[model samples]
Target: MPASELSVRPLTVADMTRFIEVDNIAFIEGPYSPDLVAWQRRFLEVERSIGLFDDEEQVGGATIFTMRLSVPDGRLVPLAGVSWVSVLPTHRRRGGLTKLMRHQLHDLHDRQAEPLAGLTASHPGIYGRFGYGRPTQSVTLTVPREHNTLRLPQGVDDVTLRLVSPKAGLEACRETYARRLTSRPGMIDRPDFWFDFETDDLDQLRGGQSKLRLVLAEREGVTVGYAMYRTNELGPAKGEVRVNDVYAVDPAAYAALWRMLLNIDLTIATVVPGLAVDDPLLAMLEASRYGEPALRDGLYVRLVDVDRALAARTYATPIDVVFEVTDEFCPWNAGRWRLVGDEKGATCTRTDSTADISIDVRELASIYLGGVTLRSLAAANQVTEHTIGSVRAASTAFASDVQPWLSTGF
Candidate 1:
């Protein structure tokens, strides 16, 4: 196919059913139901949806959730949440994905809508060429019920654990979620639709597991944390508790929630799809007896506007460093820049000074959230340090105690 063969345009509401159909086709998943499409309508608005057409036939499409994300300093900034991205298998390697990605980035940059764009990648290598970087990671864990004893805190039992209907406890859960948003680097300032957050009980999503169950952790008659999970009881010795989402403000509440989750009768193990790399649960659990922790990809971030993205978040240490950033997909960012800041605040601006470090924009994105370090990238030969000891200073400024963790997919 020629480069000029296909055109990009905003898809109409009429294309939604086929839009979903194409996603299912590209992913090679089982057939989708009308209920699936209907439920997705809460977030995937037609206005935000765009598609690639090969002479009037829609071959691929994607959508964006205009939202905000919390950074290292407990501050929230504009975030373009990209999701539902897919291209037909027949259109593979024909420059289709590049076109889609470029169109979206250009639109954001042109309009100055969002400084950062983030996504949960289906495949690890697909998005990096477009200036995206893996900034956060998760771990898959299966903890057996037998040896899942938690090191309890002094006040854990004081926190009351209440099992409420998911719908009944949603307000309390959402409030608990909101309190922890600014504490973590990658937590989203969730949209209204997402308050339901993984509580949907549709049959297509359950995979034969029981409907979502809600547990609220309360201290002093106030909500401190929440955990939503489902149970899979297929046969003898086959029961499992699947923790779809969980959050807390402190050790006691977290331990209380886990103690309840781990002891759910008849479940062989507790399966968690995404656990933060440094989650406290790991330290509290006697899990080595039955589970082997496995690493998994979490969030990928792209800095659409390098200067704006850099200055938006505060630094940990006082430092001055110049970065020679190469962003081929977004050429406006491909130049030398100066970043200066202290523990209080920071600023990044275009500069003509000699570069202290030379790096690709994608690598810069990885360090943007402070989840991955520049010195580590330098060791891997991904970041170039031209000035002696500059990487050490810059990496120290970029350090964060929160440690980035994306609690949910877009």
Candidate 2:
């Protein structure tokens, strides 16, 4: 099939039904239920959605949600949360996805609504070409129930835990999440509809596990943390617990909730997903038990408005350097810019000074959160240094006191 025959455009209200149909076909999900369709419309906007049409029939589509993304130093910025990206099987290899991505990036840049665009990638091979870099890596843990005892904190002993229904505990979970997002880089503030989506569950969606359960951690009757999970019966006397999400405001609260989930009765092992690279649970655990830690890409980010995105976060040290950035997809970012800053503030401006270093915008985004360093990127040939010691100086300035972590999936 020729790419020229397919046309991509923003969706209209009347085009939504077909848009959803093509999305389902592309993703291989069955026709969405009427109730689910209504729920989607409540949060998703038709104008913000785009579809690839083949002779007036929708064949591919994607949408973005307005999100508040936290950066280092507890600052928040608008982020375009890209989601539901798919193209029909017949449209594969026809440049359908490539066209959609090109259009989406241009739209984001033109609107100037967000300084960054981000998504959770279903396939790792895609997105890098568009200058999106994976900045955070997550770990999956399956700890046996026997060794799951958390090394208790003195304050945690005062914290209490209890199981509550999802509906009953929604506010507590949302409140804890609201605070956690500010403290952690790469976390996104959940909107009202997102809260509803996370809490609502159907049996089929549970993978034969028990209904979703909510466990809350509190101190002096004030909620500080919560964990959402489910248990599955694998045998007559043994089973496994799968943790869907967890958040906490205090160290003790976090430890307490993990302790409760780890000790859930009748479960031989507990599966925990999206643990930060430096998550405290790693130190509290007695042993690896039956599970091995595996790294998973957490979030892919693109600096749509590079100038604003660079200035939004605080730097670790004071340094100045001219950066020649190559952005093939977003050419507006392709130029030499001087960035100067420290912990107090930073600024990125167009410059004609002799270039100290050169890198792709993707490399810059990967190191933006301070997770990846210029030295490491240079070692991999992903970054080029034109001046002696510039890599070390730039890396030192960009280093983060706390590693970036993204717990939210989308």
Candidate 3:
């Protein structure tokens, strides 16, 4: 069908039921509750909700969340995140998906949202054409029941883990997560994001079950860490436990929380973490007896606006470098940006001079959170450094020792 034959318009409040229906048909096994649809519509706004309709029938829908990310230098940058992308099976191969995506991208560009756009792709191969690249990795780990013990270092004391109601624990979890997410690149939090981030998605692999428990780790009467998990029977003599989400303010608390989860009695011989990448839990263990860890790509980020995205996160070290970013999907971000940073922080601004390093926007997105390094990109020829010292300096300053982990699935 020609793009002109289908109407792509802003989703209105009246389309809620049809929207949910289309989403349900598209996702099939996923959760698209009325309450969730209502909350998402309100939180994201109708203007951000674009739908493809064939003669008033809603065939597909996509939602975008707008927010700012605080950089290491305390600079807040604008970012656009894509979520809830769905299309009816009958609408497949039609121009509905393309129209919706094109319209949304145009809208974002018009808004001058230069920081970039991010999303978790249902089909990894589909979004690359839109200049989206996998910037972060997620890991799933299964540890044998025996290797679950954790040895803590000194000065980490009084760690207490307790169960809390999901509703009651939402605020504490959100607060702690906000603090942790801002410093990490490629992580963006919406203003009314509390609902999705705090609430469980009952349909996802790790979500949707009522038996899942929320464990809050407290120290000195303050909640510092939390985990969402559930236990199930794996076999006749074995049981399995899975962690949906887990986070802590400090290393000790994080380790203690894991230990508590592992030590759960009557359960199978092992525990699994739903989403983890380069998990510290592995290092904290005494040996490699832990179950095998599997790595998978998580979020794909596209910088709609380069300057705003680069300025949003704080850096560990101070350095100056120029990046020639090629954004094929979003033309606005395709250019050279001079990023200068010091102990005080960093700034990303357009420059006409020669670039010290040249890379595609996808490569930058991959390293935006300091997870991937410039050297790796250079090795892959994803990045080309003009100056010898500049590459090392920029990579050292921008790279993060700790890999970023997204506990919530969009």
Global lDDT scores for all candidate models: 0.87, 0.84, 0.72
lDDT ranking from best candidate downward: 1, 2, 3
Better of 2 and 3 by lDDT: 2
Which candidate, 1 or 2, would have the higher TM-score against the true structure? Answer: 1
The segments of candidate 2 whose C-alpha lies over 4 angstroms from its true place after superposition are: 1-4
Sort by TM-score, top down from the best = 1, 2, 3
Residue 292 displacement (Å), model 3: 0.5
* Candidate 1 lDDT, 155-225, residue by residue in tens: 99889988899889888878888988898888888888787746667778777888889989988988989
lDDT of 1 at 105: 96
Model 1 TM-score, all chains together = 0.96
Cα TM-score per model: 0.96, 0.96, 0.85
How much is the lDDT of residue 341 in candidate 1?
88
Instruction: In model 1, state the lDDT of residue 193.
Output: 74
lDDT of 3: 0.72
Q: Give the CA lDDT, 0 to 100, for residue 258 in model 1.
A: 87
Better structure of 1 and 3 per lDDT: 1
lDDT by residue (tens digit), candidate 3, 51-122: 888787888898876665443343456656688788888778877777877787778768665556778888
lDDT (Cα) of model 1: 0.87
lDDT of 2 at 33: 79
